[model samples]
Target chain A: MQLSTRNQLKGTIKEIKKGPVSTEVIIDVSAPAEVVASITTGSADSMGLKVGEDVTALVKASSVMIMK
Target chain B: MQLSTRNQLKGTIKEIKKGPVSTEVIIDVSAPAEVVASITTGSADSMGLKVGEDVTALVKASSVMIMK
Candidate 1:
């Protein structure tokens, strides 16, 4: 909703992959491909998420260290 | 790290809140507080998160809808 939020990325659900243990979800962020980061919701569930759904990806940038 | 995956919640970092733009991260999960679901990492950053860090909270539990 608010892009001003530091680690929050709101987007529409592009895909949902359910695994035996975890689920992989992809979101289509508004930022360009450069600024946009692909986050993985590492879990599977029978509720809430679905294709075309709007959701927020809360990322703690610190946890997302750039490996160089 | 692999608590059956469904809505992956790996515990480590305890607190990180930096405002002005957005950054509020708190992760101390272990499935005790009744399935342990307290995820919020909106966003703020200088590098990677600190404060006894260890991060992994990727939940897509159907957007977590539970209303009565």
Candidate 2:
């Protein structure tokens, strides 16, 4: 799929934590680096995300904040 | 500063590419992984982002997407 965002990281599903309305998915991009994504529970369930699955984390540059 | 987003990656500024209205900041989070952020040039100049500066890349889970 084409994405407008420029940052894309390929990683495997490390963990999945579910909340009432949101689901937290931790992706192991590398040894020391991981990307945490909070998506809707409905989206998560529909996607059938599981541990050990390879997923790409898409982050829009506009959504990224640079703090000193 | 407290942010509502959960994903925070600590990295060093590697390069800064400027556009008319937006600035693209590429950060090296790890050896192979980099996070690119696009923010307004005004905010970029006001923040004075430079190469070799330490910055945190904050991504709101809401803005993160997982593609299988």
Name the best candidate (by DockQ): 2
| Chain A TM-score by candidate, in order | 0.38, 0.50
CA-lDDT, candidates in order: 0.44, 0.51
| Model 2, span A21-55: residue lDDT tens | 43333444443444555566566566765644555
lDDT of 1 by residue, A13-59 (tens): 68878866345666676864323333344542534467676666566
Docking class of 2: incorrect
Residue-by-residue lDDT tens digits, candidate 2, B6-59 = 444554444434444433334444534445555666666666655555555556
lDDT of 2 at A65: 59
Per-residue alpha-carbon lDDT of candidate 1 for residues B1-68, written as tens digits (9 for 90 to 100): 11121333446658878866345566666764324333334452544567666565455532331211
Top model number, lDDT = 2
Candidates in order, TM-scores: namely 0.26, 0.51
Cα shift from native, residue B55, model 1 (Å): 20
DockQ values for all predictions? 0.02, 0.14
Worst 10 residues of 2 chain B by lDDT: B16-25
